[model samples]
Target: MRVVLQRVSKASVTVDGAVVGEIGAGLLLLVGIGQEDEEKDLAWMADKVAGLRIFEDGDGKMNLSVEDVGGAVLSVSQFTLYGDCRKGRRPNFMAAARPEQASDLYDRFNALLRAKGLTVATGTFGAMMEVSLVNDGPVTLILDSPA
Candidate 1:
């Protein structure tokens, strides 16, 4: 499992000109499930995301987690995160999980976050989505589940 996390003032996902998911003052997660990912990966990633102290506190220090600030989450499925581009101009997506597996894992991952008491919104799995966000502090991080 891999995640591209971005702190955002607001974020939304649109599919076929209709808004499917949206959030405010929270984290935008571009999630990817690899072929090797399993339940443990989902658990670990959810725990980390829920506890990460990337939001700023009153003193202007990044010391608060999204949960602390009562923020929501906009989770988007993105298999491109696993694209391997070492060979040529074309990127290889062999490392990405098949749609069935990826969809199941992605759903479980979001459920895990929601179980942590965070409001989790999600894009349609396997759909072409347009995500828009105002990145707060331009703070972004890449996270990977432990092997």
Candidate 2:
């Protein structure tokens, strides 16, 4: 699994001209699941994302996790993160998991975050969606499970 995390002041996702998920003062997660990923990947990614200290502390240091600041998460499925464009103009998505498998794991990842006592909002799985956000520090990070 791979994830792109962004600290945001506000964010929202819309599908079919309707807002489905939104948040304020939180992190936006774009997740990609590989066909070979297992529970261990999910566990590690979930733990890391929840405990990451990317937010600022009182002295303006990047020392607080999203949970520490009472923030939320806007999770979105992002299979394209696995797109491989090494040899051609058209990127190959062979590394991405099948939709059914990806959706199941995506839901599980969200559940794990919620279990950690953080507010979690999510974009519809397997949908054509529009996501908008105001990046707080424009802070962004990418994480991938161990190979």
Candidate 3:
């Protein structure tokens, strides 16, 4: 599993012109699942995202976790993250999990985030989505689960 976490002031996801998920004062998580990912991978990545101390604190230091600032999460499935572009001119997505497995893991990952007491919103698992966000600090980070 992997995720691209973008700190955001606000974010929303639209599918077929209908808004499906939205959040305020939080991170926009673009998630991807690999063939080797399992329950432990989901658990670990969720904890990492929730406990990441990227938010600023009282002294304006980046020392507060999302939990400390009372933030939400907008999780978006992003199989494209696994695209391998090392060869030729086209990106190969062979590392991405099959849709059936990937979808289940994606749902589980979101459920883990929600269980952490943060409001978690999500985009449709396999839909083409238009995601909009006001990137706070433009802070972005990439996280990967160890196999």
Clashing pairs counted in every model? 0, 0, 0
lDDT, model 2, position 22: 98
Clashes of 2: 0
Give the winner by lDDT: 1 or 2.
1
Candidate 1 wrongly placed segments (more than 4 Å) = none
Q: Estimated TM-score per prediction?
A: 0.99, 0.98, 0.98
Question: Could you give me the TM-score of model 1 versus the true structure?
Answer: 0.99
Tell me the lDDT of model 1 at 112: 96
User: How many backbone clashes can be found in candidate 3?
Assistant: 0
**Over the stretch 11-56, how does candidate 3's per-residue lDDT look in tens digits?**
9999999999999999999999998999999999999999999999
Each candidate: what lDDT? Answer: 0.97, 0.95, 0.96
Model 2 residue 114 CA deviation (Å) reads 0.5
CA displacement after TM-score superposition, residue 92 of candidate 2 (Å)? 0.2
CA lDDT for candidate 3: 0.96
Clash list (residue pairs), candidate 1: none
